[model samples]
Target: MPVGLMLVLAVTLVFLDLPLVVIVLFSFNSSSSLSEFEGFSTRWYRQAAENPDILAALGLSLTVAAAATVIAVVLGCLLSYAFVHGRRRVTRPVEAVAMSTLVTPELATAVGLMTLFTTAQLALSTLTLIIGHATFVLVYVTVLVGNRLRTLDPRLEEAAADLGAGRLRTFATVILPQLRSAIAGAAALSFVLSFGDFVTSVFLSGTEIAPLPVRIYGMLRFGLSPEINAIGTAMIVLTVLLGVTGLWLQRSRRSTTTSNPL
Candidate 1:
């Protein structure tokens, strides 16, 4: 790489990751101060684990993320298959509309969801947060799985059809197996995105319940505590793991495609 490019990359990385690095370091701080780290300790992590409110918020976040991932994967895969294999003229416009969520500001989506819930007289809770999360993640699943589907040859399905297999059976036995990695990748992405999301969770959640991110934000208002750092560190580790897993699944899908070449 050019020297200028390398310098730019280094500066960008530092700018992005400095906060995370500080959070990880401060998670072990013996003092309550955000700056001037004292002796290292895992005390905050223990405190976080024992804290009921934090635990409740974490549970809510996980539940919302899991529920969203499941719903998004199912709907996204079906939509992706239809758009990829079925009529383009009809599905194309709809596909664009569905993915418009990606470009739409999260604040806009959050406000819209809040408005919709109010209009419907549905109370804001974990269920509403799950719905909000799913709306955004559905686009990720659809884009990833649809791209993977496009790479598949129609002859594979045709061959199965020629063998007198029912459409559903062929899909279940053949196409679904091929789609396993893509689905897994999509699920990982969906979970990470939903878990890390704050705006939608904040808007959709009732005052009675807060997701982890929102909880952490509330914690920051009073003062800096190592407990917040501990929670942030845990979340960073989790997000990294999920992101790495997604990348691995995508790579595995490519390998499978090259080796099988059907």
Candidate 2:
């Protein structure tokens, strides 16, 4: 590597990961001081597990992510299929709307959604958070699946129709199978984005419902501690696991597609 490029890479790595390394290290700290790590223990994790507020926040986050991921997957896939199969004039406007959401800032989306709901006299709650996350995450799904659909050969659908297969049957057996990897990737990416989202969650959530990221941000105002470190470490591990699982699913699906005979 070039000397300057190597220096830039090192700086980027440290800037991004050095604090994470510190948090992971201090999560096991026996000392109370954030700067000093006297010894290692899992006491903080246990304490976090026992904290009611943390537990509630974690539960809310999981539920919201689950609901959002499923809804986004369904709606996004439909949007993808429509973009690929529908008339260009009709689909272009829909695509524009979707892309606008994807490209727009998260703070803007959050604020806009919050204001809309308030104007409509709707209270922000768990349901609103789920809808907010679904709205955000589905953009990723639509883009991913729409690209996959564009790459797909239209002849395959025609061939299935030539065999006298109905539209729904051909879609279920032919089209859906081809998009498995894309769908799986969309689901995983959606989950991670929704679960880790703080800006949208904070803006849409009421005092009664707090997702894990919102709770963590609230905790930061008071101070930092091993319990917070433990929570951060846990979230990082979880996000990694979700990404790995998605990759594995996509890989397996690709293998199956390549190995199967027509």
Per-prediction TM-score: 0.96, 0.94
Q: What digit string (tens of lDDT, one per residue) describes model 1 on residues 66-141?
A: 9999999999999998888778899899988988988999999999999999999999988899899999799999
CA deviation > 4 Å runs, candidate 2:
252-262
Give me the candidate number with maximum TM-score. 1
Report, for all candidates in order, the number of backbone clashes: 0, 0
- Tell me each candidate's RMSD, in Å, in order: 1.2, 1.8
lDDT of each: 0.91, 0.92
lDDT score, candidate 1: 0.91
